[model samples]
Target: MGYLLITGGTGLLGRYLLRDLMDRQQKLAVLVRPSRRQSPHARVESLMQSWEKICDRSLPRPIVLTGDICTPDLGLSPTEIKWVVENCDSMLHNAASLSFVSTGRDAEPWRSNVDGTKNVLEFCDQARIRNFHHVSTAYVAGCRTGLCKEDELDVGQEFANPYEESKVEAEKLVRSCSFFDTTTFFRPGIIVGDSESGLTFTYHNFYAMLQIAWTLKQSLTAHLEPDGRTNVSYFRLLADGTERKNLVPVDWVSEAMATIIADESLHGKTYHLTPRTPVTTKLMCDVIQEVLNLYGIQFDPVPADVSTMSDDEKLFYHHMQVYESYWKDDPEYDLTNITAALPNLPCPHVDSAMLANMARVAIAGRFNWRDPRVAADVNLGVPEEVNQPNVVKNPS
Candidate 1:
């Protein structure tokens, strides 16, 4: 009967979760921070409106709590806090910093992943919200090879990046909390765009290579061969063309999580929202080469020698250094919990054609480096008062 309070409602997976949950007629409230250009309410309004346009139906908006997860009480005012205490009984902690590197413990990957989680736990304890749902990455397995079960968290494994390290710490923090009656964790693999639309808002890990190729294509346009292909023959990727990357579509991840969250019996367990069949590096590269008209990229298992590398290859490797561990190979993520929960809902296979479609979409949008800030197309039932910045005024 109480509203489900969620963070990270503006992210790619969060947007899909909002749509799927709203369709199921769930009472929801979202805690979102204001951007420099838009207020929290405005941001949610824009997101909901965008969904409405895409789905071709009117949708109800969640109660927008203007707050930052990194702040105490999530920066909510006394009145806002009272409303949440009275209305929200469960929370989905989804806001996270995806920074792969950390300058210090005080900076990102720590600020949003660890400290932000602590702040959320503190608020929940204060508000007496007992049920908690956490969004974690499957990579928290952290360079561990072979099968990674849903129930496992820490196995004395080493982390490839700071993002994974911070997530492990956050998961430990969440599990350590004793106030919650139910705790659920959804560990999704690399999230790509929608399976059907191939549309995505965020481009980070998987898109890095595609982006690099696209950028090179633009600058090297004059050197294109008669076959409309750009010569990337000198560039060699540090892989055997057999490394598998577990990619889950954002829509599927949202649906799987929503289904589990909606059912009370399904609580208190971990779910690996990953694909049954992982896509290989060769397949991904082939798609990129075909879609982007890139030619002659060799896959070498050994690390490239810096002395013999071309300028383009050097630039590519430099830009991709942060995700070096990410590209190594993904372990097999066990889908025991999610498979049992949603027997009928199978993860869409991301075949080469599908991957190509996704690539085309990204290429068309030029990788969307900046937030487009698309305004609400229809100003339906959004309360006028919520639109004003005073709805949750910043503390003076």
Candidate 2:
């Protein structure tokens, strides 16, 4: 049987992909870093314990291998490397530094996104690999303010963060690889919770604002941001005081990605794995506020004027640098490629209420940032860190 290999096989998106692949009984192999003390297989097993929160019943087990992308050939043992070289048929490049505000220039994105990608491509080349699937973010559109579509490039806008530039470079690298037989690039927009259960693995996307909202519910922070009118799209602006967060469930992303790989018709193209119906930032903020209020916490609505204040008052403004670019991107996808491939596969649901519910659970469950140890006053994500006016980072 043909074997499949995944780089970020343990990430939120990787969990879904692994589940789908295993359900089909596809022989799968995943690259994992050997822990200082534990074995590689043990590390993957520990990871699976965490994945139970997101994966469906169709999930299957994975064959984990000890490897590191930073080192040569994923730090694989000589024999293991040779074995993978001979048996592997398809490769999924999903591992990446999703955090936009990284420790340093190279540490932030260039290494995993660019350098790591080159290494993966090289490994395949040396192994005589055939199929390759690269997962990317839709933020590559940068500051382009309009309907972004799949397979379209060069909008002439710009990127808001270093993460965007890195993703674009990575995609370019995948497209340029000479020996790879089949390549598919999946570009997802502001990925978030599980559509059905409203569950999320990490606290990202609009979590910054929700952090404040969840805090307000507990009478923790006295913040006053816009109540309506948040400019979220090129067409209908989500007025200030309006909070819009476009999020897709991990289940949906993995399912779509798996289906794409299973089908052969789609190769040498890009696919936008975005939510069919995104929630307005306003509704996202409102639900959290109301939920807190229901819990007997007093949360007074801060006027839009005070809400949109600069970093001095709006401490979370720093992190908005990565998210601010999302103000636009009311995309329209053909779906001809996705729907055609997964004829019977069900689409994951990620509407406003669904996302809000998921947000509620994730926040109440783990994102209690108010705890001093959980980073109560860091505010490392303000828009000012973006290094540009309005935009998040400087373009190279």
Judging by TM-score against the true structure, name the best candidate. 1
Off by more than 4 A, model 1: 221-223, 369-396
What tens-digit string does per-residue lDDT give for candidate 1 at 229-291?
A: 888875577788899998888889999988888998999999988888999988988988899
**How well does each candidate superpose onto the true structure, as a TM-score?**
0.93, 0.76
Give model 2 RMSD, 1 decimal. 11.7
Locate the minimum summed-lDDT window of 10 residues in model 2: 229-238
Least accurate 10 contiguous residues by lDDT in model 1: 387-396
lDDT of each: 0.84, 0.63
- Model 2 scores a C-alpha lDDT of 0.63
Please write out the lDDT profile of model 2 over residues 65-98, one tens digit for every residue.
Answer: 6777766677665556655765688898898887
TM-score for model 1?
A: 0.93
